[model samples]
Target: MKIFNRVAAAIAAVACLSVGGAIAQSQAPLVVGSTLSLTGPLSATAMTHKLVGEIYVDQLNARGGLLGRKVEWLVKDDQSKPDLARTLYEQLITSDKVDLLIGPYGTGTILSAMGVAQRYNKVIVNHTLGIPSLSKYEMAFPSWSLGSDPGNTVPNTVFDAVAASPKPPKTVAIVTSKFPSIHFMSLGAREVAKKRGLQEVLFLEWDFGNRDFGPIAARIKDAKPDMIWVGDIALEGNMLLDAMKKIDYVPPIHFHTYPAPGPMSKSPDGNLALSMSIFEEHAPFTNNKVATDFIQIYHERTTKANMPDIAVEVQAAASYAAWQILEAGVRGANSFDDKAIAAWIRKNRVNTIYGQVRFDGPGNFGDDMMKVKQVQNGKWQMVWPTQFAAPGAKLQVR
Candidate 1:
């Protein structure tokens, strides 16, 4: 009887130990890390990404987190520098020991992070990587769903929309920032414009962070093309528009690549400004329950934070979709193993805020669902592809 009691006590002790181990494991926080241009040239746009991430993380925790464990996001500021981004990613892996990785804002920073992820064999989900040809990393996925060749696909999409307009511009002036992705897409736009038989009257380039837009704006005015493709990102586009306004000039049909959403919409000259978009806070785009809830929360949070643009546009949508992809990958893998998550993402399609995105395309890119948007009534509205346009919104050209 004494020996049997001792054996039963030992069995109970083992059971308690197993229960404690499981509890401790379930309580552990799953850390995900990334860098953003929290300061520097890309900060304005990157702030949108930051906000989206925070919203997603909050909502994630509310939903019991991933795999029944809490999630902690460790974000470092890369100051819009690609080199700094590379170093930060390394530190995130070795020192911070994050379980998952998300890429930064710009193409340069994303590419930089890509290298470190490759070295560590970590699955990286990125947004805003424009030049897909440069994205050869198999395990790396882009949330900027501009197809395999954004340089070609995005430009063609924009051109297709404009061509359908009542008075299509016969001449186009291309002014571009030498930022990696912007420059690549601008070059492709130039080729596409010429191939489509539109005359290129002016082709100008400025260094990535060039604040002096007066000269460039003056040159665009001189070219006097019927349309202008302004490949400026963040506040660069705003600065150019301000310069053009000083010269009392507004190109008849000016298109921006990645403008500061808020400033651009508020700028009086920004009305009728055209740009590309994946998702906007409008019908068709917001039909899904996930997107509907996201837009509502985004509105509430950004308004509270007093952000520049409270509207959900391409940039914000892309960032939100990236988190969705990561979450889907985690859930699909159902494991903390990085390789398994990557493999699951590669083999399956994940429904994102941007729609159903699959990574089977070239460079693991999804379909190019790029749409054109115009500033209307102090808000950005989808104007092209009739189906996705806001109620009664159509391409409005000057």
Candidate 2:
């Protein structure tokens, strides 16, 4: 990675702030920008991402800042719409002239931002997206496993665990939201179920915004699957669960890609749920000092801001990891230049709280760091990728 001394000359001279001061506009502050789903359907996940980026930037500033320049994160609400996200991103790159870019949540929003990023030749550090279509772009860096893992393996980890269980499920049902990433995950899970010799009793997909899942749940119940596999957002997952409970349809195992930790904990019978997540409060796979400090800081920040206590979810960690990677890349390249940072990321392996991180040429990280966990008696228990499982972490079949 070649280091360039271009940070000081990149932007106009701007004001800098003290530790507790406002992040006001500045000519020299390294501008990092994005459009977030702050007030729309994806707000549940995007809100956490917003806070994670804020905390990461604050921590960086406290540690002398990025390349000796303060960071100004320019985030706008996209209302969870692709068109709005695209417009905001174009504004960020052209009018706002952000020095660096971070992507918004979901495959749709991130895909909306990709064209703007490529048109401007800006490096977009993606956090919540794993769309297969985004692989062809050189400037996109996906922080999660969906991009790099073969056949979308991150979403298949739970199925792998089911296959390995002593009393493996004999029948499986797959249901998913109509979104691109969730659809892809469901497809992968279906293949894994077949390969494991589990009978595919039912396979169904629904529109993303459909609120009524009772009919779907009734269908699932009729199938009498030994296990139910779901791929969808947290909100939709909760909707489906409620529908399942409406008819008392509780399969032996209910595994999901969306880690609906909050709702799952509050459900009448939460323990039966299982999901793959990176945000478990004390997940062993990400128990390094950085991760520990992140948790502590996140708590302190939320408390200080008078916000509700929210557990660190995958969205927060993945969003924070993207910032960490950006910081590492910028410092390594010694330049705010997009091309330089992208090249550095390609040439060097960055260490993050997630693990020793190295991306494939297409900016996808290894899925080996992902963990499969199940809820038991209102607590999360690591149950897959046994090599990284925490003490006492094991699969329990009811």
Question: TM-score winner among the candidates?
Answer: 1
| TM-score for each candidate, following the candidate numbering | 0.95, 0.88
Q: lDDT of model 1 at residue 202? A: 96
Residue 374 lDDT in candidate 1:
92
Position 61, candidate 1: lDDT: 99
User: In candidate 1, what are the lDDT values of residues 1-398, reduced to their tens digit?
Assistant: 99999999999999999999999977999999999999999999999999999999999999999988889999999999999999999999999999999989999999999999999999999989989989888889989988987888888888888998877989999999999899999999999998999999999999999999999989989998989999999999899988999999977898999998988998898989999999888898878898889889999998998997888989999999899999999899998788999899999998888788899988998788898999998899998888889988988877
lDDT of 1 at 92: 100
Candidate 2, pairs of clashing residues? 12-27, 13-27, 14-27, 14-28
Error of 1 at 339 (Å): 1.3
Poorly placed runs, candidate 1 (over 4 Å): 1-22
lDDT (10s digit) by residue, model 2, range 286-347 = 56778888888888876776653355656667888888888888989998899999889877
lDDT of each: 0.92, 0.76
The superposed Cα distance between candidate 1 and the true structure at residue 88, in angstroms, equals: 0.6
Per-residue error at 244 for model 2, in Å? Answer: 1.2
